[model samples]
Target: MKKRRFWTRKQWCSGILLAFFLAAQTFVLSGCGNDPAATSQEESDNLVIATSFYPMYIMVLNVTQDIPGVEAVNVTGTVTGCLHDYQLTTNDLKKIHKAQILVVNGAHMESFLDQVIAQQPELKIVDASEGIELIEDNHHEKNAHIWVSISLAMEQVQNIADQLAATDPNNAQGYQSNAQNYIRKLEELKSEMHAQLDSLEDRNIVTFHEAFPYFAQEFGLNIVATVEREPGSEPVAAELKETIDIIRQSGVRAIFVEPQYSTKAAETIATETGAQVYTLDPAVTGPEEPEAYIEIMNRNLQVLLEALGS
Candidate 1:
């Protein structure tokens, strides 16, 4: 039997057509019951984000709301509780593991964040406090609560927007727009606070903690004394005596107590100096009602002006 010679052009064309048909059949059978589009949709919907504190959380929420298919979760709860004293639960750690983006004030502010960052080396962490001028605290670092000043807070909001936009480029435009609008409101708040406190020209103010130093520095209010000689510690007897002397000598109009601690110390000073006790929430803790950063600052100014007889 003689072996057949190679096929001619017509036979070659028929062989190519058969090969193409076989490949098409294999592809259809391989994906007979699969939906790639649905798989993609499900994957896109799994993004989760978390912020460390109330102020940070609020700013993140404002920006993330406009970004489609993204959900923001705040790991820390409530405003009234001390951040340093905050205890993270197992659920908090789960959120940490699931988060794609973690926005925090900074290491100096939220020390608790250090552990989270250590555990999740791959997590994208946005330090909102970066690049802003921080007050130096020789003991460890300076005041961690920079949100007290509206001007500083405006910068913080901008930084947060930039980080979020960088992480989620698809929604960059929305983040920028939202940030601009928020900054404008903050500037307005700054002006309103200035106007509100302007009339009370020569009043002396006293606070329970040195937390209001930035606020005093910003508004030019005379902080004659702070009840707690130190930032986050109880007042010593000598410190208490000195504060009382300052109140009496300077003719201080009011004693401002923080809602985080007992008002009894301030109340006692108020009684001795004939000055009424006024509550100025540092916003380190949460508020009784709807107290955003700006709202809390506005309320503080109102209370200060009223107590000072401006």
Candidate 2:
């Protein structure tokens, strides 16, 4: 109890060495716990789905709603209209590269698809219009504006859900359930539209462009004439006169124009033919909400009723 033991120099040095080694080990463990690579790895585990444009983006939103660990994004952000001659930006490429899947409205809608496939050969693609019959444009190219038709849009929705389920088996049930719920809403809208439109005597309409052939076909409305064969290309004097003549001859009372394009041509034709101008949205672009498509279609139905209802 009275004697105090002193440590040898060797023992002291060994103790110091052991303390240093323990401290270094602790520092290394803490550093690894906060590594940025670990965080990046966690983020990479998420299933990212990228859509080609606005319409497909909305479809994916409906299909993947509330599915955990699934992120849906659009390649083209806030694009105001159809992708007729759309060019991809570097940002778009980056988004596509980071995604695990790319959903597109097929049937030649995306003119840049070949370039995309060449660039990203490993990317999985889901074509929404894979099985739907497409209307041909004047140039004999398949019209890719299938989503404008509610019935056709419903089919596209189902196609998307099926492909998504096949691609991501872990969330298959969720995708199918969400698609069924959305399709039911679409069915209700279609029934309502048919009930109102089927009995109209004046079914003849003149459209601003060729965007509404599918829409006209869906409701049995005859497109007597079109103001423009292609969007953004105003009709020359001769074509305008011819369209006016056709509208007058067919007794077409309404000229339908898309919200995405200028209404100057439609207004000119309406003035010349005494037909009223109305907005019929193709839903190529609109609010970035989950229910934007349904809402836009509802508005279009009202517009049709006003323009066509006697």
Candidate 3:
């Protein structure tokens, strides 16, 4: 016969306590293996790229396409048009502060650049307009609208890719590959536009402002007159009369205005000169999509064909 043994209450309680302690130890070990500090370091390693405006944002988007741990954000968002007289907001400052790099059109396009550099001295800047020959604005200052020209825009993309690669050597190949892909598309568009625009006998044009000189130079269109020397400022009576006279004498049938500005001045000139008013986008502002620049430029080409093909 076998005698049955019963455990004491103290023994039972100690066994239960030991089991609980082992379970807690396992949980702590699992948590430690994950290492929250390591996760935070990985998050901080991601590159935050802040573009000064829309065009630069698009360029960065193309340059950084499909690159892991890279983000492109526009400081001025999608709605803001042109950085000519733009003022930075508090939210904008925060974005810039968090960014590891800032991509700008350069050529003095960013009026607040000096202030930004002063505030964030350690911030790396990639100027897209670097090394490209810039067209002069109405004021004789170098125009920052280099992206408006497809050829120059390709150059800017290459410049940005090169600078970004230099700044972030870890992602150098990604930047160069993406930039080359984008530049191929730009080259196709440039050839198509040149093929169409080169045959046009009527190359002289009248624009609303000084935004399109580089674009005109790319396609060999002559900008005989601009309605406004500067954006948001209407031409004076004498200046308006001079533009009308030039349009009349140049036999320019079209008066081009930007979608971002009021068409009143263009319309007034058109009414007096009997020229039709058309829209030409400078690609300063548009949809937030990466392909927005290409779409806008294609639309501009259609508008040019309609306005000038006659």
Candidate RMSDs in Å, in order, are 14.5, 13.5, 13.8
Model 1 scores a TM of 0.78
Model 1: per-residue Cα lDDT over 1-310, one tens digit each: 9778699789998787656534533432343213334224533233456888777876776666555555577787664544755667788876776566788887376786788789878678888888877665446557767777788777888888899778766567877898888888889989998887777766688988757766777888888888875445777778778888988898888888887787777777777778888899777645323237667777887888778755
List model 2 lDDT by residue over 1-310, tens digit each. Answer: 8665598788999788657544533432343313434334544345678999998999899998887667788999887678877888989987887676899989888878678777777678999998788888668878788888999889989999999888777678889999999999889999998988899888888877777889889999998888888787788999999999998888889998888788888888888889899988888888878899999988988998899888
Which ranges in model 1 have alpha carbons more than 4 Å from their true place? Answer: 1-46, 137-140, 229-233, 285-291
Which scores better on TM-score, 1 or 3?
A: 3
Q: Model 3: clashing residue pairs?
A: none
lDDT, each prediction: 0.72, 0.83, 0.83
Clashing pairs in 2: none
Number of clashes in every candidate structure?
A: 5, 0, 0
- Candidate 2, poorest ten consecutive residues by summed lDDT: 27-36
Which ten-residue region of model 1 has the weakest summed lDDT? 27-36
What is the lDDT, from 0 to 100, of the residue 96 in candidate 3?
A: 83
Residue-level lDDT of model 3, residues 142-230, one tens digit each, is 87788898988999999999998887776789899999999999999888898888899889899887888889988989999988887
TM-score of each: 0.78, 0.84, 0.85
lDDT head-to-head 2 vs 3, winner: 3
